[model samples]
Target: MELFGTEGYVNVSVKKICDEAGLTQRYFYESFPDRVNLLAAVYQHCVDIARSATIAAATEVIDRAGVADGPVPAAVIPILAEEALGGFINSLVEDPRRARVILIEVVGVAPEIEKLRLGAIHDWADLIAGFASNGRPTTPKQKLAAIGLVGAITQLLVDWQMALTDPINEQAGPDLFQVDSVHEVVTEMFVATYDKIFG
Candidate 1:
């Protein structure tokens, strides 16, 4: 996303990314079977970074709030929110063409990428579901909700792309870069859903 934005899907050869990353074609091929695999790896790497950042942020938040030893409160949703927003905005800031590639091209003619991307989402959902507050409803229910919420946020990115009624809408600002606003909004909804049924 930092180099190409969403349109990176079209004509975004691995050679280019490798060239930018200062690696050779042989190494690229050795690392990734194809572009799809490479794309998946990129997604995974970014998601992992976001997850770690989220956990650290959550840990800090809890510690600052002075609840270090107790049963960790339900936090997977907030973490996901932070990840989603950051992912979307950072991708845009890193590469305007990345969004096109990630949200659009990767899903087309690239089952491998889709597999990795969707699997990542499911993994996040699984984490969220598994880590809900104690005595919560069945895990399946939480997983289902998590999956839907993630999908909704993902679609929201696509929606923003569609809403841009310009030939070249690439003027995103620094405000979005600080936090994932879309995720921030959606996380509240999920939190409320959990509170209503489980609180």
Candidate 2:
């Protein structure tokens, strides 16, 4: 997983993967049937990491804001939005390898991973809907918009990652490496959109 995430899916060979882990090819085969299987494992691993991080962060916000048993206070929404987005974005930013795996490496890898990816997208959309509706039931249009929001977020992250690698984009400034600018803008957008849709 580490090898695939860092070196890229296509560039990582079984032998290289094994060597990176200081293991033999025999050990690799024993664990994973093949490279694609290893990739599937990596993809699932990243998804799990992302899910856990986002859930934990959101749960903290809910608990800390004392919204566990009653209606969430409007005052808590910005905090919730910022913390939740911070959780998701930091999960990727803190480890560029995981970002690479999620934002780049897993595309069209295999049927199994693709299935997981699609499911993850829906799950993220559900999360977004929760934010928009503030625990109220989401209308079909809201649900569709939630999905579109997730897609937009993904594209933004992809572009951000691309900028990190491209020399031309790097010339913009050092702030590009820091995600808070993007995070702040996203949080504001989310708050405004949520209020607009279900204010």
Candidate 3:
């Protein structure tokens, strides 16, 4: 996670990671067949951490906001977004190494790397869809609505990336995902798009 985020795929070396871990070349090879595999592991582990944190933060925000239904919880949306966005920023914040490794190095180089990067986005989309529907949808309308809402949340992240500096919640807008119980406009995009699709 550290090196991958710092130096990126191209610059990171297995020798460096082994040195950091205080192990021999033999040990590094024993654990990973290639640098790419090692980097993939790092990416997966960090994303897992971020994903779990996002879910927990969302739940807590929802509970704190006293939001049970209507249009997905506002507090939770921002919290989830923060967790997702924060995880990456935490790695890259003021650290050029991580930025080069993660955000710069591997992107568009390989499909596998792209998969790792987008995994969390897809998961978050599912969550947004669930919030829009309050559960798995039983009807086409509901499912469509859920997907639309999820798309909104996913796109919010893409736009956030474009800003290049603002954190997710800040770039996404405090009101980015709020609608009904949500306080974010992006969330409202979920609501509006969902309704429009269903209608």
Clashing pairs in 2: none
Off by over 4 Å in 3: 65-106, 138-188, 194-199
Find the number of clashing residue pairs for candidate 1: 16
Model 3 / residue 166 / CA error / Å: 14
Which ranges of candidate 2 are over 4 A from the true structure?
A: 167-178
Compared with the true structure, model 3 gives a TM-score of 0.59
Give each model a TM-score. Answer: 0.67, 0.86, 0.59
lDDT of 2 by residue, 22-68 (tens): 99999989999999888877777887888788878888999998778
CA shift of 9, model 3, Å: 2.0
Candidate 1 ranges with C-alpha deviation above 4 Å: 1-7, 18-24, 72-105, 135-138, 161-184
Q: Could you give candidate 1's per-residue lDDT for residues 53-114 as a string of tens digits?
A: 54565566556645666644555445544544454456544544545544555665576666
Per-residue C-alpha lDDT of model 3 across residues 86-195, encoded as one tens digit per residue: 44334433444444444445557567778876664556556655654556453666555555554554444444333454445564643443222232555455445545
Q: Residue 137, candidate 2: how far off, in angstroms?
A: 2.7
Candidate with the greatest lDDT versus the true structure: 2
The candidate 2 region of ten consecutive residues with least summed lDDT is 166-175
